[model samples]
Target: MSESIDIVYEALGRYIDGLCGSTYIGTARGMVVLYRGAEIHHLTPLKEPLPFLNLFYRKGTVEIVGVWREEKSEAFFLRAAAADVRLFEDERTISIITYPRTGDMQERGMLIITLHANMGMAKTLKSIIQEETRFIKKEEVVISSRVSI
Candidate 1:
């Protein structure tokens, strides 16, 4: 496998060593899993890169939601769902700022992992999103700085 592939897989799979799916039945699905939990996460891509993202706050963003559970089935990463994957920072957890294609927002429109899981879960989801985003997005450098004496 390519080094980048190894790098990404290793980084994401760091926590999977203790989780489920350690058995060897195969089932035709891939053996590697990054983070598996009760929550079902949705993933999307950014067509255009964001202008800037501060490093300290940008770590631990998840890109691919979950692993493919079956062989012939491909994990569908939604491109159009970009609009629904907005991030809203809360006191502890980052709420997935989702919206329907039409109509108004309702009680059934949002999702959160709770405060205790802010980093454990929310950060993983965010990290997956960020990593995949970085892999696909071209690097762009912005210059210009002001000097104050």
Candidate 2:
């Protein structure tokens, strides 16, 4: 199963690179590695994969967070409008919130990504949603005065 997961991750990396023309970064255990056309970022064991959530976004950026098997869990959330990515853990779930990006209307758009994992699969399940928030427009008021102040 771990081998299959590795293949899946490799395929995912290739797919992402092909789609965005950006390099893919992967981690396992505690090491980090980068993948390009025919190159590898690191050669040492430190380049090995990690057992946590890996996030890919904005062409060449990847973020990873640690997870405890017995204590807590980790997940990734993305906000497209703000070009923001969030790493949420079990302890911080209450403080988790998504906001709009500056220079844009507060209700413009949002894209959310959530990841979940189990014990045996060695894979993560991702859920994505694209949505728009609507706001009511306010109209200016005009006052008329008949005769005199």
Candidate 3:
């Protein structure tokens, strides 16, 4: 892993150690999932969609919706789907935002996490969108000014 990715993954490792449930970390290349306590899974994106039980949509600001999951023999895999994998070809992305699923929510949604890889400097987080239960949306300017690249 690169230095920046190491830093981010290190921080995320600490966070995941304390979570009681599963959490996913997506990158431009693939996904790293922490299931329960110490079970970790690395998954690659599937070109075609599968018959997944829990389907969700991954969308970016560019309006491209990518298929994000695949299931085979009762195992699940995830990909950082954004319509096209190449959309993040030049960027090093680490997903930091996601909406919590609720029973009453009509549709599943994902928040955009776009990061530009600037090896030794901090990258800017752009176009973060959050939706409320009342249908109100709040957009933040920058999530963190110190996200190392």
For model 2, residues 1-149, the per-residue Cα lDDT tens digits are 44434434444444454346532233234322323235443211222243443333222222233322222222221213212333343421211123324233533232222233332212221111111112121221111011000
Candidate No. with top TM-score: 1
In order, the Cα lDDT scores of the candidates are 0.27, 0.28, 0.26
Q: Candidate 3 clash total?
A: 1
Segments of candidate 2 deviating more than 4 angstroms: 1-20, 25-83, 91-104, 118-149
Q: Candidate 2 vs candidate 3: which has greater lDDT? A: 2
Error of 3 at 68 (Å): 10
| Clash count list over all predictions | 11, 7, 1
Q: Alpha-carbon error at 74 in model 2, in Å? A: 26
Candidates in order, TM-scores: namely: 0.25, 0.24, 0.23
For residues 9-89, write the lDDT of model 1, one tens digit per residue. Answer: 542353243133221111111111111134333221112221111111112222222222222222221111322345555
TM-score of 1: 0.25
Ranking by TM-score: 1, 2, 3
